[model samples]
Target: MTIFNGYEQSDREQKLNILNLPSLEAEAKKIIPTGGFGYISGGSEDEWTLHENTSAFNHIQIIPRALTNVDQPSTNTKVFGLNLKTPIMMAPAAAQGLAHSRGEKATAEGLAEVGGLMAQSTYSSTSIADTAAAGNGAPQFFQLYMSKDWEFNYSLLDEAVKAGAKGIILTVDATVDGYRESDIINNFQFPIPMANLAKFSEGDGKGKGIMEIYAAAAQKISPDDVRRIVKYTKLPVIVKGIESAEDALLAIGAGAEGIYVSNHGGRQLNGGPASIDVLHDVAKAVNHQVPVIFDSGVRRGSHVFKALASGADLVALARPIIYGLALGGAKGVSSVINHLNDELKIDMQLAGTKTIEDVKKAKILRK
Candidate 1:
């Protein structure tokens, strides 16, 4: 039985009380369909890599320094030229409508309240414009999926800029969808209709707008689309899903200002290296020319420290926030982030660091 098992969400405020990441997973599992649950919760075949993602953090230990006047520690981190209050940024999750009625709107608002950022997915249930509006133009970024059609691609970039997204994050990892057993078994399609496509095309059709554009472009359009989108918007571009130094180099060549070292939470491509494992190398390859961000298996403040030591300028968490949302919409989401923020501050103080930059200067061991 899971932590959320047999428990009921009593009220709005109570939702935020669900502090731990796994604490809310149970509620989400019970509320969503088997397929939907599987899509969001399950991992690739065998899920060994998923388990390893979290377990890998176990090998490293924080060597904290004591006896200094460490009072209020700053958990702030900057990404794509924006300063956020916490090292935690909201990961781009697709089909958020599957988790809550208000979906990304709730998420954006909650993040706005905390003065943080959420990397809005191109596949989000709410339109990017609408999600930004919900956040009232708070610090925000757009995650892009290169579609087959360049026109649709350009249109979406235009929309992101018009909607007040401060930057764009291009997802290059999902060239083809990964082998997610839950999505396959459940035959998962997004629970909500693709609501954001109407602005690009006027009818109900698969691959409309970005999807259609993505289909047409395939591998042939990737490089050009990257340049095109960058040319079209002054907003900084971050290339996410880069797994290697080579890809990182390519991202830089294409004028990307940042890269997210992620493997899609082990949801795609089982048996791949953990995000933390490759972080150091990726960061080195970029030679500090641009910032490197990471997601996957970051469950605690120490894990946040580990990623920073590994060279991530910012770290993001997905399932944890989604788990929080499942238990209670906006408030639950804030609870999870706040919990991390509290823990991070405590951890930094214990480590004798007063700011996030100090975290970078602290020593780390990979054993």
Candidate 2:
């Protein structure tokens, strides 16, 4: 498959204005408010895991093959029964309004433009139905946080299914809000009302803050909760927030259709090992029983390559999408996807791989 159509001279000139991923981030920092930037960019206390996530990729080296016939490499693959043009998916992130006015809807549109998949967070500024509609029927997954009220959680699941969500991503790592120093200092509050739960009354006495509701609801999740969620949905259930082989096995045994290995972008757990560092063991434990999806600290095509080589069937992008959105809404988001797709294609050709499967088989050496 043609992962990225070559850019025109005009388009190239426009892209040169934004350039690379770090440049996009630098641009985003200039536009985003201090509180919003802090919330999106900061990890938990000390930020050890945050730094480790990206640095882990540095510990491994890709050994490219020589002189292979890779004149027309394809980046197409199937994951969880969805035909993905590229394995790089837009990771579920909350409160997109903080990044852009259009919020999750803009993200959906951007992902749809490139035939990429999106996982919409429960705390999204756009409702599941609205986000699905915005995608114009592109494949979308619902990222669910199990609520203390089982009825509420089940109702949300039903709403997502009716709205045409292709799968369910049950996030398991956030039982409580992380002690983010930035959020604490800025006293950051979700800028927009959560579209999905806007009509639902806040009679639970959890107050009106989004973070409070998220923390209270997520506290109810357990291993049995994973099994319950799987049974509740006919669509595939992907358990996100898995960080080790042990939890990976537990999630699989609980009937998860897929495993998402993450640390909530290092937004949770101050000093945890990087998600990439745990990916190999998690993949081994799953043993191909289910696909392993990865996120947290993927910033470039090389990071994408390393994640796949480490046994991630597909990788997700998070903070970068927000950065893109901060720079230019849907167009900026599309640019980020296009840039990554183009980079991945070039990396595959350079690495002498011709398909997504070839990427899976590419050699790697630990430094």
Candidate 3:
């Protein structure tokens, strides 16, 4: 059994049989606070979209090829001019400090160790500079939540550029928090300083709900916002939260360098189609004009492979990586990513795919 650092299983690993994402999540749940876990794990309203996110993967089936020289396959890919060892990037999640002392710093170091990228969230407890310092020169992108304040937005972008962010991820779907009942029941409230928001916005949001804080800050985002961010940052801008080809096209028309297909991990728009279900259409619409980064139901190497085959250039997930971070800090984060990549290698070999490109071209049946 492998543990953090990729070798030498500890008793925790052995006891938990922590070999898959599900088991990893189960273990991490025990250690994190009740409300924290609920906030991390729950979805909006009835949680239909959340459940659909993962379950949707089962309907897509891969037909493996036989007798290909499939030895020594690689998972390496390039995004935004950055060479990454794996296409599985970490999706941005907020308030990682609630899970561990080091938070995004630990996450960046671990991902650097594993050769993937981290999309640092605007709400991350760690600042861009500090997170970049911890990454030790790994390529990282900054996820923008387009605040209602223009000065705040410009200042945030300015800081990202100074900190060496390779790209800007403009998240558009969540202008406010979804109606997550779990949070209501738990009375969930953030309890730490948001380092990036210190100058313009700060504190633990002591008396506010997640919804209230988000509502006060998020803008009525528009395509023009995309243009402005691209112009200001002069960095590749990936428009996240796209569910339709039309929206994807709108973003592209407005100067978005990339299109990110997600449903906010089912934390927004509860009745929507699984993010995976809409990917091929959106990717088809993009028509290879830009890279597609996907998330919201990924839990397996086959899921990653399927997303690639379906059209995503890269796959990302937050719940699993953060769960890993909660359980073991940087090494835990490394362990989670390394395990998935190992599974990706095995799945590629079993499917007789020789490279990441082969996975992209491999046959898949949507049942």
Candidate 4:
């Protein structure tokens, strides 16, 4: 299907007026509670990495080509055995109830309708089963944080498979929660219980009961654990939170089908390099052995182009999805995806590239 399919003129007018990433974020801030906004928007410690993630893109310049036949540029590509309409997919962010009543379910529905993919978070307010059901046959992946209890981890993997998850994204960066000043100042507590973990509680189940399990899982994750997870699950394994070439190589060596370059969106490490800054190095190290997925600080279509030109096979959107979720639930989320898709196509046409493969060959200059 073409990018313009089902995008009406009214939708374009509405999006032009109030649906860009920054505007949507502003709208979300006005609607979401102070604590909720803080949890979704703020990063760890001083937020140096947070600012750098987007700013790092400015250091690179796209050198567009002129006089090329580019009537139709295809954003379509395949990853993790799923054919995606665009290279962009929604990154896994936890506790969507903080933004809206529908939480992850709404996000899943929006993405599915738009033919996008979502990686559901381990701390999601909605259960994997419900989120998968919401996808309505759209592709979905399960983001897992290793649990100290091997049995618990195995149980989660079993559940994901049963729920129809297409793949497993194992996050290794956040062994412990980051030091976010917003959460400290707002005294934020999750608005809803973690749906998956809540099912395991003995009585009066709540989010607090899952803390010990989460902590244990984080502390127990290791490089060797990657192999164990791959061995245990029939689903393809994609390792997320890899920032350096060394770690990227390690993940590929450990049998990862995909290497996701992220710094936990600057939410875990205060001094980490932007995901874009490290994308080329990690991608080079992986050497096309596995698909390299990138996240953190992607704000516009130009950023998406730069990532692909640099080395990322695909890109993921994080905070922006939450912003859309806050403002309009499924509709808001779909608007964000549609806007990005539109921008990506325009950017590709301007760059004289006509497909996802051509994006890799597009010329870029680091400033």
Leading candidate by lDDT: 3
Clash pairs, candidate 2, are none
User: Which should have the higher lDDT, number 1 or number 3?
Assistant: 3
TM-score of each: 0.90, 0.92, 0.93, 0.93
- Judged by whole-model lDDT over C-alpha atoms, candidate 1 comes out at 0.77
Each model's backbone clash number? 10, 0, 0, 3
Report, for every candidate in turn, its global Cα lDDT versus the true structure: 0.77, 0.82, 0.86, 0.83
Q: Which regions of candidate 1 fall more than 4 Å away from where they truly are? A: 1-14, 198-223
TM-score: the better of candidates 1 and 3: 3
- Root-mean-square deviation of every model: 4.4, 6.3, 4.9, 6.0
Model 4 whole-model lDDT (C-alpha atoms): 0.83
The positional error of residue 131 in candidate 1, measured at the CA in angstroms, is 0.2
Stretches > 4 Å off in candidate 4: 1-19, 209-214
lDDT score, residue 264, model 2? 93
For model 4, how does the per-residue alpha-carbon lDDT over 153-215 read when each residue is reduced to its tens digit? Answer: 888899899988988999998888789999889887665678878766667777543346545
lDDT of 1 at 189: 54
| lDDT-better candidate, 2 vs 4 | 4
Roughly what TM-score does model 3 have, to 2 decimal places? 0.93
